[model samples]
Target: MLKELEKEWTENDRRDEVASQDRPVPWTLLASLAALPIAAGLFVGGFFWWRGRPARGALSEEIAGLSMVSPWVIGFMAFTAFPIFLSLALSFCRWSSLTTLDHAQFVGWDNFRSLFGKDTTFYHALKATALYALLTVPTGQLAALIAAMLLNRESKWIGIFRSIWYLPGVLAGVGMSVMWRWVFHHEHGLFKTLIDPMMPAGWHFPAVFEKDAETWGVPAFAFINLWTIGGTMMIYLAGLKGIPKDLYEAAEIDGALGWKRFRNVTLPMLSPVLFFNFIIAIIASFQVFTQAYVMTGGGPGHATRFYVVYLYNQAFDFHEIGYSSAMAWLLLLIILGLTLLVMKGTKRFVYYEALKA
Candidate 1:
């Protein structure tokens, strides 16, 4: 009986192996089936164009408009739209950069499950990213607004000051990262030299690249962020210039002075700009990668592994292209959700005069 059972199992394994050997994945057929909808869409579009064809004279300007913008539209379709849809499809399939697309084994929801299920690294990366965004966005905005307000004046040296402030922003990101690494060097960096002497005995400065760096790393990045407030400052300066002076005059008439005038007049008028900057800051902050990647490589044991950097490592370092693609899509969803939430929360506070109707 045992010999007969072993014989049956061996036969079943042989049959399964032969079945797999006899058939290969029909990627060509799959591709054709996948393209059928796109082909149908193009056909419908062509039909509509022919059916709704108007006199050339009526559409000359329209044609001219489309012709003028055709380059951008074409570029967007090729570079942006195509890759977006490709990534969406790839997210569901297990493929590596080293392998052909045809070799991608479809494993729907598995990548997402892994990310959410037992992947502690994913959670850590998410936490680091969220914390960095929270710490940097508001602080950077406040610093930028203050600098803008101080510089919003007519003077011979005002432009010089503006240029000086903006210079840091235009510097190469990797170069800046390298520079900051040295500035935060564990023992001999500028920070240690400047901050160590003031400390009491037995107290140590939080060396951002070394011991207990996790506690101080994100904050150090936030401090580095303050130095690159030039872009935000320019935007705030533009918003300040746009505010009607009469509003300030009215505030003065109403006995609203100093901070009261700013709160009542400046803030309401500038709310739209603030809203815009807030949205932009959130988007940019969540995608923070270069500085962390260059400085730490998400290390001292994944302490500073930010979202994008983690995604990057999954793709290139671990060869988990499918997982990384899922991570990218998840990030898109998160950003979109946050943006919508902020818009909903701030709608009443944002002073869109035209929208008041």
Candidate 2:
């Protein structure tokens, strides 16, 4: 009986093996796998042929070049262009990222109206940003120009001095801001330690990081920015180097001494670099964020509340994405208007060498 049972089990296993061998393979999957290489080959061949083909005109060459960049163009449209337009649309709608698109309500110009008419913080942020730009831009430029003039020599140690001066600008951003926070600390801070001893008995240094920041915030921030004048100084140095020595010779021959030669020759020659730096400084000053955010946290009764910090608070902290978008657009408009005004106002002063020639 045991032998007969074992024989039956063996027969059953043999029948299962035969059935597995007779089963059909999936032709659809096999065809798809086979077609992949053919499709790839055809695409590659077509691309090479198009590239190697002789173009009839400049337009044809341009079209071919554009075709090669079609992928980047598509990506930019999908990622950058779409988001920009969506943000602009959302600026007019009451929407939150937490909600579905279908739930977004049309609010037209309500966001803009509220910011202008109702929000005091918006105005305060604008004022603070304007104040920061006013204090930092001219002072920073002047300091950088002076440093550049002082270091504009062809000595062996000049490169070392340039590198030393440039170190601060290179060390800018969040890390620098955090360092400044410690430096400006109310008690046991670097500035306090240095200035406290110099004061008379019972006299104290100004509380730069405290309530007095309402009066001193912008200037303090400007002082911090002044530390990073290395970059601007390098630009000024380059401009100074480019000024023809012949101009100085001519001025000296005309009995122009001391400040007179500088006013006539160096100032006009460096005007283009000055204008470039001015525009960059203005834009950068308007967008000041890191130091104010890290050091003051927009504190001292919103005295250091920069426009960007306010925008960030609205978008993330308050979950007012629509309002933030409106603020961003407003800031863009302000920068654009200021840039245009500056360009128009300084057109006469900006002496272009090519134009003069």
Candidate 3:
């Protein structure tokens, strides 16, 4: 019995020995792991402190400058940067604005594919917007330049005239649209009440906001947009004022008359301002929404259905927020490409040093 008990005790000791080999990790090792990051951080802080010791005063001023700009930095990160990145991410998602982001599903290129393949409204909106940009940019700039030329002279009434021209620019966008509605109101409008009677028999004014909208709607909007170019006119006026009078005098001496002086001297010198105006105007033209939204509500059919209006409809009207996000990115890419192309194509024409057009 004593021998058997000794053997059993020996067997228990062997099992315990084996269990000790599989013991929990050492506290020392865990403590070292926890301290490693703190040690590294301290080392980095010490190095930077030592390096900046000589320029401590400069370093403080830099910190102060950063402190002053921190609010703006924070605001941009919160408002602009976050939304931009979120929109980009959401473009790849099948998510509605009405739903929580947690509900988002990953759908790779389906949104973009639908945009290019199946959506007819997207194509119509794109085409209309492209045409509007093409028609308006050149004509609008020309009109603004002419208005500037007319107002660029010395006169007692110059301030009043300029104020008159620029007042329309500051008018509230919605108010302007409302006023235009009255002006184009089929029956009691400026055209219908006054000019329709003076027309030849069987002739009638075009219902640009309604029945004849498909034919004349975009052009009507383009014409109305002329009044808003007062700001552009003022810019052109400033550019005109900057042109060296000597250039015009030299042209005149070389038998260049009024038109010749304008063509040879004025246009070339004003090319920089022209370039600036073109870029701003083309962007504004593509993003045209308020007038189309208010005046005709994108109208009887897709007549005045501009790109942004259609995008807005897709988002709010149809609740295709993800699709709308895709459209937004697509428009951004298109505008960016067009801008690059224009910049490249007009590199020779945009005279920083007044090269002849």
Candidate 4:
């Protein structure tokens, strides 16, 4: 009986040992395994640090400068970088703002495909945006250049004129929208009122706000944008001021009259500024939202629907967060491509004073 009991006890011990061997590894062991590479990296980094101890003061100065700017770096990473990555991830997801992030399902290229293939509104918005940009950017730049030329003179009233021109830009947004709405009011508007007297007895101005809004919407916006030419005017004015007086004197001595002098001397010297303003205007025109949103609300049969307005409607109004993100990325790509094209095309024409020497 004692032998049989000992045999049973030995068999039970063996089973216990086998069970221990077969069991899954503990969390502690798994953590240690994961941290092995990290520990090695730290050791290697310490060795390098010790080897470079002679340059410690220079390193310390660099570190101090980095520390001074660390807050901005941290803020940019947290706010801008994180959001950009998150938005990019979400662009490939089937997500609605109505649901939580946990419910987001991975949807490969459906958002982009839908936009390019299925969505008719997307094409219409793109067309409208392109047309708007084409109309507004050049006209606005021309207006600004003219104003800059006029205001570049030295006079006591120059500041007042500058203030008057810039005031509209400063008071943009809702207030400007309201003013425009009043100005374009079909019957009672300042535009109609002023034009009424000049017209023949039977002739009347076309309804800019009513029947003509669909066809004339872009032109109307371009006109309104012309009012805020002050910002671009300032940039052009700065460029004009920077042009050397010697160039004008040389042109005059060479018998280059007003138009010739302006065409030859002024245009070449101002090419760089013009290129800068052109690029800025193009970008701003592509991303035009406020006036279209506030004034027309992308209305009158989607005639005034700009790209950003469409994106805004998709994200906020329609709750298509994923689709909106896709649109945003597409817009970014479009702008980037256009900017690169502009840069490449203008490489020969863009005058650099340093390069001339």
Candidate 5:
């Protein structure tokens, strides 16, 4: 009886030991594992739900959308908005690398007075830039229009000719400048060869390399701009292609031909396209820097001193960051004002058939 009791106790002890070895997991750890993915899912769902919520005002919607694109908004604020405001502030104060923020004194409109009232170079640069624009815009647009008309003709191998004309415009800037430099080379230049023989005795061509060439005020840069208009011509060509052939045929049937057909049908039809191209061309021409920089370096007595180039010199060369900032703002305002003026003027001229009564 004692042996049987002892055997029963041993079996019971063995069963309890085995049960303890296979222990159940802790409730805390099990709950944590279950909650992890559920918590993650809830967070993800809440983020998307917050993004698509309705807003109270237009500005609120804008802000919400901007929040969704917060990275870009942050970037714009840091890079563009902050810089502009800082510039405006800087323009009103005198600063230097050695000077701390406390050292910057309020100068009021002294900088503006210097730029407009005292600095003769500012007016000269403005005039040069304006002249460049006036010469380039009208001539380039006319040339492009003429080239487009010629290309629009339904003839064999016209595509080949169009491509040939546009090749110069597509050439790399350095390569184009180098090529143009050769073409305008005074001693062995093509223009020299063509024009020198036509002149009377004791007269040489107006040399851009020579001193006092600015006073001559010739259109040497104008021709360079004209040569670059090949690209613009191609864009105009594309615009011309969109005009229906039926319209031209209908005009021809109504006794429209030559200049009359062009004036009545082509011009009216192409007015919208012309307006768009005109604005683009004007904006581009006003920002003309590469050719002048590469070729002239604002030399020949600062004849080709473009606004952007001057601004660049002020910012980087002279370290007049504040002054440069002011110039940039001025440029922005001028461009904005001009664009608005052009749009207003174009309203009376540009015709759209879709919008017509």
Candidate 6:
């Protein structure tokens, strides 16, 4: 019985091999499908390579070249490039909600004039947003740096603690904002309860809504923001883990203690990470929307009047699309300028690990 089974298996394998050898190849079908694109690319390349010799069949070559990238090129022009141009054009015009798109009369520099001249709200909001960025960016970087240092230390359950620190960041956006709003609730919130007990009978705990009160003058908006930025801190902690322990050991051998090791070794090594987090934090803080929109609606008289919120109000609520486009362009310029400044400044401080690489 075993001999018969072995013979049958051997025969089956032989039959499978024969069938595989006899099967038709798919190279013809693949080659046929690939030939058209390959031919077109070669033609376009040849055309560009011999630019002066491109008098003949230039239009045909251009057409063929465009045919390949038509979908992407068209989409890019329609969605991105055209819109940017349109916004730029719109910034030079004056248009309101009631005005038709075609009826947007050209009024050069009018919108920009309005932004800087009569618009005191824009000035106030911009100042407030700048102040928020100043407060949040430095503080957030310091917090992340401290967390990174703490987590870099040798510990068994460091991963678990790291997750705990990052937990606030993963909370659903709406849920996190709502949770923060509750914590900042003036009358019966945790913050109020904490402060109320310590105060005397005559002096009551002031709510966030009570703008008139001088005693409870805490900026609740800023507190809410800081609470949600714990996730960014975790990212820095991870960056710290990627650093070599040997560097620290070398520093210690050189008689470097806590502050010295941190200043000379840790700070220089982590400069790239710090630069990344600082720029990101600045951009995010400037465009702060969700927390302010959900919690305050840029209220308490525009206390949380972030740049994006202002843009959103201009676009949607005011129905000033042209004006909003102008604002968007201004913001784009601002962010681009700031990013360029960061890149330029990074050369002085950011330490790339060329020795290790």
**Model 6 over residues 84-197: C-alpha lDDT tens digits?**
867886666545567666555555565676677656557766877787777777776787678767877777898887777777767738788787667767777787889888
Ranking by lDDT: 1, 2, 3, 4, 5, 6
lDDT of 4 by residue, 184-237 (tens): 888899988999899999977766656786777777888899888888999899
Over 188-221, each residue of candidate 1 has an lDDT whose tens digit, in order, gives 8998899999999988677887777678877788
Native RMSD of candidate 2 (Å): 19.3
lDDT of each: 0.82, 0.80, 0.80, 0.79, 0.69, 0.69
Give residue 207's lDDT in candidate 5 (0 to 100): 60
TM-score leader: 1
**What is the RMSD, in Å, between candidate 1 and the native fold over all Cα?**
8.3
Q: Name the runs in model 4 displaced over 4 angstroms.
A: 1-56, 197-204, 354-357
**TM-score per candidate:** 0.89, 0.80, 0.83, 0.82, 0.75, 0.75
Candidate 5 lDDT tens digits, 221-280: 777777677877877787777778898899999999999998887788788788888888
TM-score of 3: 0.83
TM-score, candidate number 1: 0.89
Quote model 2's TM-score.
0.80
**Best of the two (1, 3) by lDDT:** 1
Residues forming the 10-long window of minimal summed lDDT in candidate 1 = 13-22
Ten-residue stretch with the least lDDT total in model 5: 13-22
What is the overall TM-score of model 5 with all chains considered together? 0.75
Q: In candidate 3, what are the lDDT values of residues 33-134, reduced to their tens digit?
A: 756876898799889966765577887887788789999998997898766756776676666568765555666676787678766667778888888898
The all-Cα superposition gives candidate 5 an RMSD in Å to the true structure of: 25.7
lDDT of 5: 0.69
Which prediction has more favorable TM-score, 2 or 6? Answer: 2
TM-score-better candidate, 1 vs 2: 1
